[model samples]
Target chain A: MSGGSGTRNTNTEPWGSFDDHLIQGSGAAVIDMENMDDTSGSSFEDMGEMHQRMKEEEEVTAEAAATDDDTHDDGEFLGMKGLKGQLGRQVADEVWQAGKRQASRAFNLYANIDILRPYFDVEPVQVRSRLIESLIPVRMINFPQKIAGELYGPLMLVFTLVAILLHGMKTSDTVIREGTLMGTAIGTCFGYWLGVSSFIYFLAYLVNAQITMLQMLSLLGYGLFGHCVVLLITYNIHFHFLFYVLWLLIGGLSTLRMVAALLSRTVGQTPRLLLCGTLSLLHMLFLLYLHFNYHKIVEGLLDSLDGPHMAPMQRVARDVAELTLNASVRSLGVTLRAQ
Target chain B: PDWFHWTRTSFTEASRPFAGLSDVSISEDIPVEGDISVPVGSSRRDEEFSTLDEPVKETILRDLRAVGNKFIHVLYPKRSSALLRDWDLWGPLLLCVTLALLLQGGAADNDDQGGPQFAEVFVIVWFGSIIITLNSKLLGGTISFFQSLCVLGYCIMPLTVAMIVCRLVLLGSSGTVSFAVRLIVVTASFGWSTFASTAFLADSQPPNRKALVVYPVFLFYFVIGWMVLTFSPSQ
Candidate 1:
């Protein structure tokens, strides 16, 4: 503590201001911890809890002294000053920024659809190599990674909306009242993604998963891109039954696998599976719900694009589907009567 | 460096013109047939079922067993240690062919395209694998381009199972039962492929960039898996 004061007194670099701020911050935190009584949502208590957790993991506590490991930069900020007791969060912040940029590059490459992978790799960096191309729809799975924020999320959001608009325009007679489809598409896409990511975050927290909300948010955001494509395919195509099944399996596995991997060390298997199962089921339901009410929701928003644009044969196929559904329902009703 | 040398040699060998285009016996006694065509990108180390120079009948037998092991890995993906013991491309090439046929059959009733178009499937697989291989190379993946392709090809085993299930489900049932079966198959296979592919392709990348490569690799298989799973008769 005396050393901290001496270092503060001798401060000379640009980081000195942040150092002073951190000193004040830590000082206030220590005071708060000592003075506060039991209070709901008490951050002081939370800090103690986090600190206790950190201490429980010996490697993490040891890592506190070693700034070499980058993964530990996230999760918890000990509020402890630098090893010298003088270095503030500026150093940590710089490390964090570097990590974020590296993350952004990877995320950007995977998220950006227009980014072409060259025939041969000239760049020495691996991140640069991840850009190799194929016309396969498989790359579509990586579309959701765009949710890593910055321009990633917004860019895909626009792409998804445009896809919706294109499909809607091609299929619908008059409902393409320019901005309405765009508005609804944006609303639904954002609403579903934000909701799902937050929901996963909440579930992860409940399971005591060693994850941050932003991290969970980003994971879900990336995963949601695949879900949107499934929806778009369902909307544009004559039948989405196969696509629905595909989404459920792939979507569930992807989400669960990703979430499980992220918090693998923090959360146990049973609870982890439970959380993933729930999230997967909820997403499946969301896709099904999206499919069931697709027309009702989008077509309900009446505009110049609302008239019938489906071909006569397409209408026949729709009727056939309705007929099968009716027949199945009737068969169930008959079985009930017999019982 | 030897790895690159092998890669360069294979590319040169692949581009070389063979003398006779006739279906000649591949026995060692017939040395002229040794210069026959091979799958593009397949290296000397990539001798799937049989190398041209190796004893043909014996190599074929060995390859059959290797394929069995690889296929068995599909059923028991957790036995990765044993499964990946002998990696080969024939299994994956065969897998792509089977998948293409399955897709064609699924989309058969819909007058969009008829029969299994081998070229399209080949082009698509080649293109996708090249992209993934390039990424793996850049990410410092130890697996060779053909090796990664082969592994990825074998990883599609689950998807093949899923596709078969999808076709069967679509044929015999509808609604909840169909959805339930498909859900189980797809989830299981997707998890399998994702786990299997990632396990096969894991590298010494920094944790962050590992995800950068791993996630895309995951998606690459996932997208391919989805195509295989969802390609069924139009409802």
Candidate 2:
């Protein structure tokens, strides 16, 4: 009981007014940047200047709203010059804001997984919501913030790598020395992420999707988070095909969700559809490869990534034995069986 | 016009409470405190807001000198965030002892393999923690190295429970029933440890670095969870 009382109580919570401060900070920064831009500006002016302008505009807008009674439109930005550029700037600004939250959600979202499905459905603000943490990564026209998502992707890679490393370590104590086992597992985890991310990036680029390479890396990283779950559990458990399949199904769904979230709406609808469809099939194949070729691939990677353990003479001698002595032994056994 | 419609949907939901007000009236709702219309955004200076200014307690406890107190802290992580600082190793040490004891029971090798199995598991867990610590450091995380280990080591509590269940299943069940027990226990613990540890490590990373650190910590636990699931007493 005393131990309960002993926990170091903090005077201030770790995060104080963090959410509000972040919003305020971002607004200030956005306004500053917008005002500074000669063109491609997202908002109107300097803080002091903007406040005065807003006050004047508020009266004009109030009168307009009352007279026109058009709830959605009390147009002012529209009547100003260069409408296309203005719209582009606005979209760029909103996307910047939405992406920050999206990126965080991509990482922290599943830490509360009892109701992943319902969580996405409940926050129906954008198409981004529909795809995040969901199984279907349908190509939407937006992406989340990059830096956290970028770092988060690497974390997933590390998770997958750690899973493979520990699995190898688990076997080393159980079975043979497997000197190269850890190295191979490490290489495989790294290679899988790099290869898959590159492949997806290529697909996205082919379709002219607004998906960035960094976002793709994050998606791959997060996608592998689910796979790491699958590998950690299944690889350790013995030969339970059903359990493996079920975990794969769930992991695939999440990966698909990331794929959808990564695809920018700038992508043509046709190629975006093709890319998602292709990636889905590719993911299934990848799972099958993991399942069926698990041992074979590990062994091959061990040989490749493990570097040279045996001396060249030792390898040559073994090859000679297989060619001459083993062949002779096989023939003798066949002849004896015939007799 | 097309772009306006898109932005409207994306942002309008948050602005809905003001929809009924005229534009001038809505602007008038800007909160005032002292001389300024403060840029608090969603924050309000309401008296009912819970204050976090409590008496600060040092996470390190003098009671940690006693092994019993250490064990108690191990069982109850929040009782003392000793792991949050450098004052205790008991939490990880006790968790390991309990884990080894649990794993030792119903083990296939039983007595001879007991010490080795426990050592292997302990080493793997600690080593995995180091991987995460290093990754966080690489990403410019602010959490102290030992603090990372403490969060990771304490997270073993859930997996230890799973190990206890494994020992129980070994004692009382066989065949299909045994497999079912193992699966359920490991999965639940896997979920708990992954989520719990993430909560601790989540804020430590520069928000940019979370993907790198959090994901690996998650995978490391997954590996531990797998060991618990696959464990069977030797024939």
Candidate 3:
């Protein structure tokens, strides 16, 4: 095909001006032999290129084997530049060095499978154990070692909690839109997660506490397992008195989990106490928000967040609703006893 | 001539039930063009020009037609990205604003009443679409960012309709029958929105992780549908 094209090219006259490349026109037979020689020369070049690539591959494998021995010692950030060979070199003070190390670590960690694996590679057993450990509320001694922080479990928990709350709210006689409620529930969960985590992280930074933002996020995410339990219990239990009891018991437990998670990272007694109290108050406020909003207990409290104050009659109506709810429970118990 | 042919065919297709006859007429019309070729000569002369040379009114009208075509596509979703390729945000914006306005009216009756504010609904719709689009991108979806957003936003039309229906139902009476009616509307629209979005987006997603992309899309529409379902005018 090339020889035919070469002959055609030599025979054909230029469509436009012929002054530009008149010297290059040659006999078709000579051009065809040159094309064959060029093809043979290219084959030799290909062989050389293949040999070079094989040599490069061997070097890469040798380097990999060398790095394999130091895997445990250097950890995942072994190849990171600023972190390695910093024994004697001092570009700046320790604080600056620390920042540099962090920056380098951050810069180095792009599309890294190892760094992202823990967030997504969650097992059911890992999640179950984390939830069980979260149920304990506080673990001062082996706190860091106990529950592994993961994103997948926490993300699923958020979605599951949203679904459950939406279903639970819909089944009940709430006047609020479930679609908007779902959005709000999602906003509340994620907004609460991100907002509270950042707040605690900020507080921890203020107190010179030792914790990373991811660590704080992971801890708080696991803490949501307890919140799910509390919401689930309050959702199912159905009696107002039992609701409050479960709310206090389980909600308080979840609050303690958050508090302890944050508290353990703080250095001093004062910071610990402050974080504990603040986290507890925040968790309790969230519980109150969830109860009033989801349980159809009082639209007044939910409304008062962004809506106008309850009318005088509306407050009375709320009271009446509460009384009716209790009365229905009593009548149900009596009917059951008679049966 | 190509542009004229495209517009003519599109116009014919737009007119329901006449599509087959118009297609047959198109084949016949070309031979007729050969006989009396004045318009064909003019079009051939202008063939080198692009849409940039088109009049502003024509451009706007064409875009409007495109938006309307997308709405029709959403109304009767099919597994074809042909309509979605010419993506626009106008339809989504209109639907988002209408839905938000409906929600704002229901929640914000009193000035002091802090309910689902207009801005809140606006943010949720836009922000949720963006987040879902970002998720699709992260999951190796072949679709562009705005294309995903356009699909997600355009799909909200059903939920917005459901919202309107719910608002109307709430107006007549806030009774069990009304609640049931709203539930049915919201659920149907939710399914429609999900189905329509997936129809458009499923082809662009990685085959193995298609569900990962669809899940967020489902949740986004579901949240909007839930908002529509649960809306009660704060008295």
Candidate 4:
């Protein structure tokens, strides 16, 4: 207790007359040192009281100095003295200010949509040509130096697939909501895109291949467009057997395109082939997953279309084919139904 | 040095009033073998709460009881700190794995591969919680990192239950009725999770910034609930 008083007395000697006037004007609370000594030997009360006195003194001086010639000095005094109150409060204030600044800085990045336009900008002709280019097994002629990927195309492809799938499913008498179908489609589509792109990016990095994430994203995105086209055709046909055949044919073609893109950037022979094979396998697995889960064969394909140019035997054959197809699809659905 | 001494003195001052009372009670009634009536955050270690020569089974049982108590606290959430005071990750890990496994099973039932869906659910739950915890910490919440995580994870119990109920509903039949039933269950559980987590966490956050801390919690549970609601065993 005596030591606490001694330190306070020593620390206060450095203050000038202005500080003394400020302390005196605040209250006699600062001058009442005897009351503190009678409390306890613990220095906690002493320090808390000292901080309380300093805070009052600064507040009083701040008002007086604001009207006088020491405004700038009092501002600095307030800033420095306010910090000595509570550690947790001070830390919270500092963190809140820093976070506010960081949030604003981050929000500014999206303020200008033009900055994001680079990822979305493409002509209709460009999209058509790119979709056609993706359909080809390989692009040997006029291959660009770097593959330019766009998120807009991939996102549109996903949206289109979700739209067509919902339409086809609804036409087939399946009662599902748009949001549910859209969520599943977007989750599976982008999940595969992001997962496979990161996988390929990691493999490329391992082999020291010079490729950017955008290239992998664009490659996979375009590959997905091929699958999306297959879905569209199958939707039109609504034939289970035809859908399978198209899935295999177009799935293989898209895999080839992805391999060609990867092989062009890589150097080594064995690693290139291994990477290509693994990637193609993964791509096929994703396609198969979609085939089983997402490929809903809308019924009445034969009923909806009329082949006017067919002979009598051909028409009879078409009727028989539709009968068998509808029967088999029904049996499969019944067997797969939950018990 | 002054701050350290000040904190210690304040702590001692706060406990002084209760010291004599506790001492008198201790002399009157000694706690039994399984008595866990020791007040939390006391100066003594957990081992000293009971006898030192306790059997292994008793210790395990005590720990299990503590975990169960936390689950009950989450189920019936009030403005209590029991969840925060005895925080553990075991319950959260269990809930996360169970939910992920149930989701994976749902996919597998459709003759689809189960690995990706399991990993997807696992990553979403864990990654989402970590992001929420980081946000809370960055917002100057007074809670400890693991404490917030524990609350978030334990609150997932309701959603995990909802997922189980959803899977069972999917088993009965899938149509608009089943979908409606699953939707109601998921929505109710999602609300329960959000309320329970915020109840445990609200006190630790700054008064003005409670909404900031809660918005992320709301989003985190909403995403999980969306996954649960949209999950179809057939698909």
Best by TM-score: 3
DockQ comparison, 2 vs 4, better candidate: 2
Candidate 1, position B112, lDDT: 38
Error of 3 at A87 (Å): 15
Docking class of 4: incorrect
Between 2 and 3, whose DockQ is larger?
2
Query: What would the TM-scores of all predictions be?
Result: 0.37, 0.42, 0.54, 0.38
- Give candidates' CA RMSD values in order: 24.6, 17.2, 18.3, 21.9
**Which ten contiguous residues of candidate 4 chain A have the minimum total lDDT?**
A311-320
- Report how far residue B206 has shifted in candidate 3, in Å: 5.0
The regions of model 1 sitting more than 4 angstroms off are A1-339, B1-56, B78-87, B107-112, B115-124
Task: Kindly list the per-residue Cα lDDT of model 4 for residues A1-339, writing each as its tens digit.
Answer: 221221332122222222332333443213223232221222443456566545544554554554454435445566676644444544665576557545544543222333444665555557667777777766652343356777555655554554445444433334323334445655667778888889989988888766788888888888887677776565445566777787778888888887887777777888787778888999887766554445332112222332544222111121123422332155554555533
Q: Rank the candidates by TM-score, best first.
A: 3, 2, 4, 1
**Residues B1-235 of candidate 3: C-alpha lDDT, one tens digit per residue:** 4544453344333224233445443444454322322232344545676788789999899888888888999999988775555667898898888887788856423454445467667876887788677656555455655677888889999988888888888889997789789888899999999999998888776576666667667877776776677677877
lDDT of each: 0.51, 0.53, 0.62, 0.63
lDDT of 3 by residue, A1-339 (tens): 221121211112222112111332332221221122111112233345334445545555565575455554555554674464543222333456456445444543222333554455444455567777766766672344333555655665676577557655653544453345556667768888889989988888888766787777777777677678776665544557766787778777767776766666666789877777777788777766776554443354465664675453122222222323322145665666577
Tell me the tens digit of each residue's lDDT in model 2 across B1-235.
3433443343233324234324322234555333323455445555456445533342233334444453345445443444454434567778777876665533334343355566656666777788677666555555555667767887888898888888778778767668777888888888877777776667655564455456677677787787777676656
Q: Which CAPRI quality tier does the interface of model 1 achieve?
A: incorrect
TM-scores of chain B alone in all candidate structures, in the order given: 0.65, 0.63, 0.74, 0.77
Best by lDDT: 4
TM-score of chain A of each: 0.42, 0.44, 0.55, 0.53
Cα deviation of B102 in candidate 2 (Å)? 8.3
Better of 1 and 3 by lDDT: 3
